[model samples]
Target: MTLNYYPDKPNSESDTAIYLFLRIGKETIKIKTGQYINPKHWNTKPDKNGNHVKRSYTGSPEFNVWLDNYKKDIHQLYNKLTQGNVAISVKELREAINSHLKKKEPTAVIGFFEHFLDYIQITSGERSKSTITKYKVLYKHLETFSRDQPYKLSFEAIDMRFFDLFKNYLMQQLKHTDNTLWKDFSILKTFMGWALDRGLHQNLTYKKFKAPQKDIEIIYLTEKELMAFYHAALPLGSKLDKVRDVFCFGCFTGQRYSDIANLKRNDIKGDRWTLRTVKTDKSYFVPLNRFAQAILNKYKDALRPLPVMSNQKTNDYLKELGKLLGIDEPTSLTKRRGNEKLTNTQPKFEFISTHTARRTFITLSLEKGMRPEVVMRISGHSNYSTFKKYIKISEKVAEVEMNNIWQMAEPKQEENQ
Candidate 1:
């Protein structure tokens, strides 16, 4: 393969430059040292130190297996790149190339993974926090999926059938949501495009991936439902209160579950609270509301410099609590599914979840006529569209609010004793 242009480090602070390279096999073509940008990705809150935090998807033990496979693929790719073991003869580079390298010469199928990892580490840092998280999620699948489908395979071996099945595998077999399916696809498209644009592939690009659908409802809890959730009885104890308080904290602050898991004492202040949002790096502050303050005060004895609840425990307990709340109903039927189904029906829970806290907080605030911009301050959302999406006011609430706009001048008379 030929190096069209030698990519370099972004600035003096870096020693290596990320470059792009390509390899052509007898029947298979390979693209190495490439990276792509995701157009759509959801991110988690940053750690107190302002580092990106990992995210968890909703669902169950089944999803755990999927996530594991995805991570394994990334690790494989990471090791091959950083350690320079992508091909038998591809030794470690003496210097690092911090940018994408353009390929013009016919090269051998080696060092593909190594070159790819260098790209991963470099681009991962520059992308938005959300996009970075997305890369992590999508790459995991790429890693695992590529395990069975090695890089040396012919381009013709991959077709719309494979791409289509992979889409189904992500949504149906892997139990991803409609939104998650598209998100992974979007991320994959960018990465795949990096290879295609650099002349890595003989004949393949991201445009080939098909979308499943686009009609998932923005479901969230109601104000009355939220009140019931907050006031509902749970087994009385400190440990349980910790989870409950954390969930309530999400309701009050609208921070993500991952962000809530990393909360520390110093992040709080007297009479006010502030933090840059996890998903988007936008900063915002709000006068600590009464409910939020009370939860903090109650947890004072057990407070640490980090967030209150462990994500693993909180998520598990949330499922239990959801069932207790009667919001999630039990599903008893099991049907045959291949490696391409979008979701496998699992037992449902009664109440909502930590995510619901965020959606409900924003939705209820909207119902009370809170301005979108002001509500964003508390929720830490950077834009109006995202804030609007989480606001789940039902038709009934809108009708009631609408009725208050007009009325007859005269009122019916009532007798007084």
Candidate 2:
């Protein structure tokens, strides 16, 4: 293609020039009579001086209408010059517009994170609702951290360095633990797996960012202490320890929070509470222990409105109540796990989580020399390793029985005094 031009300005000295023109090999077009307009007219604005100074129109609504008309004129001029020959598709127009917009900004990738979020929602149908909520928070943090990067770190596109930095942020900045950091990493890894399956960009730093061994210490109150904790908590009313009750209920019946929270009045029949857990989809026929039933009765009004303790409020409040009961410290409780750090200011119990209830059930039952298989069924553990992990060797139980069999070998009491 070639172009010929007629230079025109209102103050021009030449009147012999026509309009600018273009030509292809055998085809040619000319615009000799059309109006000549300023090139900067597409991107103009008025100055404060109120002068009709040269201006350009931005791609705003007002200017967009004008740009389309101008483009039509150009296309017509070209075809009129080339005899209706240069056919362009819609794709070409889109590309041209995109190129124009991109040039207005730096070469950095824009809205990459936005696109990444859309990709995650579209592809990862396997993610839990809790996970999606967490992803939103993670995405917000990533957006702040990646302000200088070309692309926003995405859920699935994050590298091992991203994980490393994120874990550091959670630990050093947020003061979360190894287990807490692991939860974040696990979600990220799951998202990466989703991304990998969908052929998205893979991270190079996953192995390096991974935390080691991912072990957590599960702890709970002893049966004696649990009773004390509950009796102490009895005065708190609806502000009661539903977690403790639910946990104790879980300890006795082996149901998880997912199943426990969804339990309904209809779930009970002939003193047995039956529920199918949402997480594992396992149905449990728990013969409601008297302690568990007492929890249900105490919280009938509070729990009638909702099934599980959905807020962290009850857990926090229960910790306060536990302190009054002397089961406040981790070491003060017999069935409690040894890995927990005890608080001094007793700023309240922090080590107690929902899992403590499950562990307590397994610990107590195993301490009583209950069969592992029976414990597994009650606790709903599908594996022996998991059941064994919670089967704590009760030092008190061993010490209490230390001289019983040996003393029997020596002799028996001849008379009752």
Candidate 3:
């Protein structure tokens, strides 16, 4: 195939739009490159009119590079289309060229998984970076799963059968937890929905595929336990001491680890703390309790409430702190995969991380008589289902709260008298 450009009209003015001509098999197709330049700067190898222009006047080097890249893109598309002796036509070529030119980064005819990753990249600025990272990780998992599949990964291939096979692979081959599998499939489903909305793929079998999730036991520190952890003395000037301060701050303020680690003095407004959440851009206002206030008072001379540390390092220190505080109670985790029920038990401290702080806040808030909606507002939770998940109410606590409710319903002693 050959690519060339010419003026829109034979006697067009100096500033006329240039259009592309593609010659294939037996047909020549016209494509509008949307590039306008002076006719005097036009270039034609051979033509009837003596307008045999060679170079453009407006920055020839840049224009030449752009033209060369455009031609290279078309040629690459042509080569990709001709692979496997596939039938090719001028209309298909034009459409392919159009698709290539429209992309922010042209690579090839993208498959399902690749296009999902591309979407993530293209909208990187609009979405949270961590969210994009999760999507990329999901893509990697999909790519690995596709390697062993009978067919290439495409939208049409993501039917119910493929869902079952993929779920089995994640369970038997990858050994993913029920929660992990559910989250991964959720991302996949989101991408598939996006593809459908954009009219990229027609097969909607994924819409009917159920992404099952078992109730995960949320492990968190109770009110007394949080106070115990708070007042627990650590070695002076130790990393554990610093991490404990930040972890307690998170528990009190209900901020995420990312937000806590990056919290600045400016974000703290007197007794009320205000800052936008990192995962979601929503802002929250949480009143600092005496415990959180005491920690900040301890570091009054510092720029922030606590010194920042890497999340991984903080978790590592937290484990040591938990062990120091004797938080080694036996805890069990159970999850269901297909016909198998998997269970694991270990010390609670082994599972404690920065996330426990937020969970502690929500659970303790509800335990302390805060309404679910109020706690949700403080925690920046948008939905009741998600808010309820973070609250770990024991049967004993439930009974006590219910009894209190009954007591409130009782008539006053003076009125009975």
Candidate 4:
């Protein structure tokens, strides 16, 4: 077996990563040492004592010591694995070395909630603010469930029994619908998987925990309703007018409330607006239609391209605006809590929210003959499963429109006859 260390980027002036190269028989493996140094400070060749880095440079002594110890650890690990007389490949050897090198610091014994907080802290940089907020919300729900039932929450305690208990608590006590419960359980499973990867516990019971989700009704404005709402007059310079414009901007551009709120004047170029979506962080180039462009021109002299409000305020005002414009078609929504199915019917205007704008854009776009792929591109939807819901809504709208067209055509044929 031969082992050597080399800079990842030998020609680079900036700091570069170092990698350990190992060759045993016909098997060769390269692994990152998780150390970085400038190319000038890194030695490509070993000296008389077979040391790649000399102790002359700053921090070189400590770095060399770590390298020496790392090599020794790898050799000792290989011998230990071979002494069992079991065939071991480079993959197994590499994994053992990685575990040894990247051993997590010993954490104090803590409850599940405390460990969850630590997980949030450590992974905050990797997750979006909204995602972290959702995780925190789930944490609160779990805390409440634990306190109410007096059940000890720990990694080892997460089993089929805990799943059943928590599932019942979410449905019976919290009255969460199937969809909401599914989302919460999904986040819980993600957290469990993360904890498991860190060697927190070997419990795999969460893998069997299932929370089925049901498709709830998606509400959006029809083309005629959207046009009427777009042209609805409000008091000039009023909050409602601003909210209408911002909401319509989202409807026209197929963007979320967060993205629309964060839209900048610099993001617009000609008739197109290119910006990264706040939720997914995916860049989308949305072409501005006549209506969308008009809204932009209306707010040309304003601080922002459009007068954007907080998501909550915008959603509140959208319902009010929808009601004012007489967009009051009745809509019904059905949801499930455990085995009980509950249905609620209300004026469609009452259901209008910031999210409705994007749905309206997608539904109307599909109904008006835009292909699903094109709509998905503008909406930044990579998953067909989620986008399929909008397609189903559009198909229903098309059926209704086709019936109307056929009814009108029958009268025209009779008149011609």
Candidate 5:
């Protein structure tokens, strides 16, 4: 085997990166060394004038030392590959070289994904807690997928065929809907792209693969249901009562649960809540309606409108509150996976989470003749298309709206006719 070092391409700095070309018989494989210096510094022979030109890297002893150490490491890797007269493919050789160079990095796909999760937390200080949680779930799904593999996966294993197998695994084994599958695959693609950017992996099959997604069926409480929940009797000052008030406040104000959970006394201005939103950084002034204002008045002596709890706990309490209020109307849900159709029916209250409050606000507001633009202001939705999706209109509400429009447009019969 012969190892020749040369530049793969010329960079704008006129300095080119050096790579190792391994020639075994007629087969040659090139591997990047991730080192670069000026062309003048890389010459190993005399000039055309027949005089020896001093190496430029010699001027920097620190750089020279690092270069020497890297070269020695490469030599060791080459020896390791050839030991025991074992035949090594170009892929194995490259993997060995990279594993040696990056001492602590995981060579398997699973290990790299774990490393990536840590990297996201450390590097992405701006990511929200909920956003981080989604990535954590994505990692868990990857662990499940790789649990049955005979050998650990590498970047090389993530090709077009792998995507097919993974999609099947998610459908058959995990029983994931198109939406869930889409989310998982999208996260995987994002991580793979991030890896590519950092030179950790070179697989680009994910680029050709498109994640499956269908329009989500938005479910929200109607005006009657909202009123019923508002009037539901509960012992005064109980935990459920307080949580119900907070949830009702969200339904009226169209604010996110995170924003509502973090609502401070200072964020209130006169009859309006004014501040920059936590996630979007956009300024908003949401005028409080009677229902929302009443909830605030109940906790007037406190520093904030409601006692704080973790989002998960709040959601758990909300589910229990839904059950207590008899909001157990059966809600039918359906989704598609490839050629198969899947369906389920459950109590609507079982699906009541913090997000439902925002949806309720949007849907009920639209049902009560509020303009879409006005509703968007309170909901902090900058995109009209996305704002439209959040409003889940019932067939009754749609019929009522059409009748109202038709009645207004009706022509009066001429009295003289």
Candidate 6:
């Protein structure tokens, strides 16, 4: 790709518009640079370096500098668009150039919130519903912060100062945990990156801004608890009963709630389920276990495979079901806010949600001596970093079991001795 400046009417004596000539392969795009010059000072012939503006003109120095910067901006935009082997059409290139030029003027640039909406609009089709919801939540928090603090939120206003202020706002004002703050920061940075790629703003300070984050405890039912919940009697066709069946299906199959909710009769082939997961869009083959198969047989005549409710409703019902099942062991969660550690303890039943079924499956599968690779395949876990957490939980369970066995055998050995 090449970019050069040319006069609209090179032979005219009066001032004429300077148009940007962008040539990519066989295609050429013309864009008005919004800079004009008299044709008398314009040079139609290109210099050795392909520069067209004559250096002998009165405004030649500044004009040349402007052209150089314009060329640099065009190339930067082209490189950003083509990075990662992305192919760009001539129309896309033109629109990108126009968007970049519009953003160059401070008055023409939209505010941070406006650009964020644009980001959502452009990415909504590619993102999941839950992800889009999270983005909107972040936007709301930022909006609240801007309003309460009476602080202007613009691209130029996002820096270390804003980071510190936002952190304090989330932690102190909103009483949010560090992990929540970290997620908001992460989302903010992602938006900034999207804006940067579009030439919306050149603020790089958000990149250096960091927030504290620590892993939260994973909540899952033990084997005894899972079995108890599965067997707990509710009205046969009640909401809780249906929720239990769906949740237990996930527990038995290690599939995600989204996948379970969307599972159809056609997805079940022979003794295995072959379907693409909702979150990752990856195909998974989950062999039918006795428990999973039984649950499916119970719902075989339903419109869908399982009587799955909305995720929010399912989570609410799960907590209610857990309470009924007496899964109320106290669970403590630790979080950080800068240098301070905050901990909250609640009944384990309160922590149970649709996702808990997935964690329960992974943890129980590992504790039951299922091979890690096999478990990962069934669970559709691609990232080792994420899968390693369940492995650690299983290891702790094994350590306790081994200690108990040693204690019992040591007593016999001592008596024999």
Candidates' RMSD to native? 18.4, 14.7, 16.4, 19.0, 14.4, 15.7
| Model 2 RMSD, rounded to 1 decimal | 14.7
Model 4: runs farther than 4 Å from truth? Answer: 1-107, 407-417
Q: How many backbone clashes does candidate 1 have?
A: 38
Tens digit of per-residue lDDT, candidate 2, span 9-108: 5344322332434444555444443333333331233245322223332112333443345445555544544465656544453354345435544565
**TM value for model 5:** 0.65
Candidate numbers, best lDDT first, in rank order: 6, 4, 3, 5, 2, 1
Cα lDDT, all candidates: 0.55, 0.56, 0.77, 0.84, 0.74, 0.85
Worst window of 10 by summed lDDT in candidate 4: 408-417
Per-residue C-alpha lDDT of model 5 across residues 1-417, encoded as one tens digit per residue: 765566555343455677766677887777676665555555444345322222443233444455556556677778877889888887788788777768834465555656667656864555567766778887776666654421134566677767887888888887888988888888778778878887887788888878778867777887888887788898898878777887888899999888888788888877899857766767789999888888898899986668756778778888898888788999987799877888778998888877888999988888777888899888999987677565545446788878988996668878984
Q: 1-417, model 1: which lDDT tens digit per residue?
A: 322212243333322332333332322222233421111111233335332212231122332343344334434443556565344323223122212122222376544454455556778656656567677666677566554332222333346656765766665557776656766777666666776667767656447676654433444565665565678776556555567777877777666776666566777897676665555555666566788887788667764632466566776776676666766544332222333334344444423556767776777777778887788777777666555454544445788766776563556789796
Q: List, residue by residue over 1-417, the lDDT tens digit for candidate 3.
A: 777767787576545677778888679878776666655556655434323344334235456667667667677778898899898777787788777778845466777766887788776776676888988988877787765443346787787767887888888888887778888888888888888889999887887867678777788997777887888878766888888888898889787888777677887778887877777877878788887888888998976668769889988988888888888899887888766788789988888899999988888888777888888888888977766565546445788877988886667567554
TM-scores of the candidates are 0.55, 0.55, 0.68, 0.70, 0.65, 0.69
The residue-level lDDT of candidate 4 at 351 comes to 91
lDDT of 6 by residue, 271-300 (tens): 899979777777868999999999999988
Model 4, span 1-417: residue lDDT tens: 788898998998766798888889888889777777767766688777666665544445557888888778777777888897878877888898778767843455676898899988887877778889989999999898775564557788898878998999988888899999999999999999999998998999999989978876898887888888788878878999999888888899888888887889999999999988766777869899999999999989988898887888988988888888888888898898878989989999889998998999998899889999999999889999989998888788888888988886446445554
How many residue pairs clash (N, CA or C atoms closer than 3 angstroms) in each of the candidate models, in the order given?
38, 10, 1, 0, 0, 0
Candidate achieving the largest TM-score: 4
Task: Count backbone overlaps in model 5.
Answer: 0
Task: Please report how far candidate 3 places residue 216 from its true position, in Å.
Answer: 0.8
- Which prediction has the highest lDDT against the true structure? 6
Which stretches of model 2 miss by more than 4 angstroms? 1-129, 148-170, 202-209, 230-238, 241-247, 280-284, 293-310, 329-355, 383-388, 392-417
> Which residue pairs come into collision in candidate 3?
14-39
After superposition, candidate 5 runs with Cα above 4 Å error: 1-111, 150-156, 197-203, 275-283, 383-385, 391-396, 400-417
